[model samples]
Target: MQDKSFSPERQSAFDARFEAQKIAFGPIVFQCVRYAWKRGMLQALAEAGDTGLSVDELAATGRWTPYVLKVVLETCLSAGVVQLRAGRYQLDKTGYCVLSDTITQINLDFVHDVCYVGMHDLDRSLDAGKPLGLQALGPWPTLYEGLSSLPEPAKTSWFAFDHFYSDTSFPAILRDVFSSGARQLMDIGANTGKFSRAALAHDAQVQLHLVDLPQQLAVADITLREAGVRERAHLHPVDMLDPAAPFPAGMDVVWMSQFLSCFSEPVIASILQRAAKALAHDGQVLIMDTFWDRQRYDIAAYCLINTSPYFTAMASGNSKVYESTDYIRLCEEAGLRLVSARDDIGYCHSLLRFAKA
Candidate 1:
């Protein structure tokens, strides 16, 4: 949970000039480290433990020759992902995380399989305010529409990345969601029905309504049905981006988990306006999402703020992880008032409750 990320306080110890070179050749080093992970060099070093292994010893134990091993190891050594002392190489903390940390593993795969190739067109995506990088996957207008069709490791990695962050947070926040004794709950952006599955199972009396695009609804329908919770669910298929589209009405709670960040500011305002219109007089709208500025740790903030480029080039060009203030102002503009807010929810989420002003 702690990171050795560069801090202003570490200015004396962390050399800015050396860091600049790391940025310059980052793509090569990234791939080399990835190659090391996939090729089992880092794992070998991890298993080698305190004594470590000489380059010759490591080569003797593995298929990689000394030259090839040195190529990967020397780069990692410079990156501080591995260390060399007394002619033996060992996995550094960063290297160990690369091999075993779930978050790091998920993120690495997402970037490599989903974003790496498409990121080349980031300049074009930025200039046009479109997900030009999505072209790398297929000819779908957005990633959501193409998700079901994405091929191979890309498709699997995409779902894994999306689910890892979301699925972990549901159990921790479901209690807060149902504490009001609400029987009607709406899940907007019900990706794969994970939240709906949790909500339906948590409270038997609760009737869950799902609103999403037709394509995603198809996937969620099967998931909910398979989970045996589809009996209490209603599926509403509509694209909220359509200005004329109306939200399903009279809900006790409207949930928009990891949803609003898929839009631009004006589009978010419009969606919130529609959600506000659909709310019962006393209904609350719950938004659970990652706001980069709200993170307590620098590493979380670092990983989050960097996700904007992925949005620009791959997901939705104009939508990036937002700050809480941005959402607060948008909600207020839509005639809603923030009633309750909780932060540091499971897996870097904040739950904000809003009611009609």
Candidate 2:
């Protein structure tokens, strides 16, 4: 499909006013919707069906005062999440999605529990070139370093958001990763060893090497052991940022999934160079990430673009959701060639396959 562009001339003045108001009240509307969903207001409306429910009925059912119900419902109505007719409130298409869509729920929780507060430090993070917002969660310089230790709702939301995006692609990715019949595969940034366990299940003959930080490896160790794949799994603990440290060598395939986006260009180049050196003569390095510019739809592109600020404020400040061209150029700098590029593999991900130059 061709790229989508906004054309003000094609829209009515009313449409322009609507768009302007939506942007102006975006944050408030978001919170109102979230509150409505959490407080059972949306569910009550959805279940009310064609006839819907009046404010008095909803207030009585939810045991909330009509005054409180009116305040939130009005905001929801303004956002097109709900509609009112004959003093009855009904769920609209957007409201139903807000209540039932898994992706929507995940994104909402991630923003509220993880990114919202930290985002206030975006300007400071940009000016200082560091994850200053990370202070809200912990003293760690970046989110990755403190992933295992993030407190309460932030920890839960962080893992949910991270896993939801990557887990769906694993079935297809496992087939692709093992297509060359690679026996020795290295999983870089093997957070929780989810991919390693999947690989072991897919092919019992394949031995897996998982490389990651010591804290993350600890979590992966338990997961692999419980899955009975510990016998075939080897763990290597190393700080990927340390340029002097080298990757374990002679692997048939080096797999990085949603991993490289956690670092800046220089760090990514350094990591790729290490992977290139570690690969066997016939081996390949596979990188799977959500490259916004390569997305098939504008919605996917929009989500990916908005996620860049999370990296600036909470993740490693230097990294972002990169364009595929950026990764291709970095591969060349690291003495590797991009052998293949595949887009639209599971959700919004793109895979770039590289080989030693």
lDDT of 1 at 342: 95
lDDT of 2 by residue, 1-357 (tens): 345664544898988898988888888999999999998899988988979999888877756789989999999999889999999999999999999999999999999999888888999999888999989899997888899999989999989999999999888888889988999999999999999999999998998999999999999999999999899999999899998899999999999999999999999999999999999989999999999888878879888889999999999888899988898999899888988888898889988999888
Return the clash pairs for model 2, or none: none
lDDT of 2 at 258: 95
Regions of model 1 farther than 4 Å from truth:
1-6, 9-14
Across 128-179, the per-residue lDDT of candidate 1 in tens digits comes to 9999999989898888788778988999998898889888899999998987
lDDT of 1 at 238: 85
What are the runs in model 2 whose C-alpha is more than 4 Å off?
Answer: 1-9, 12-14
* Residue 296 in candidate 1, Cα distance off native in Å: 0.9
lDDT of each: 0.90, 0.91
lDDT of 2: 0.91
- TM for every model, in the order presented, reads 0.95, 0.96
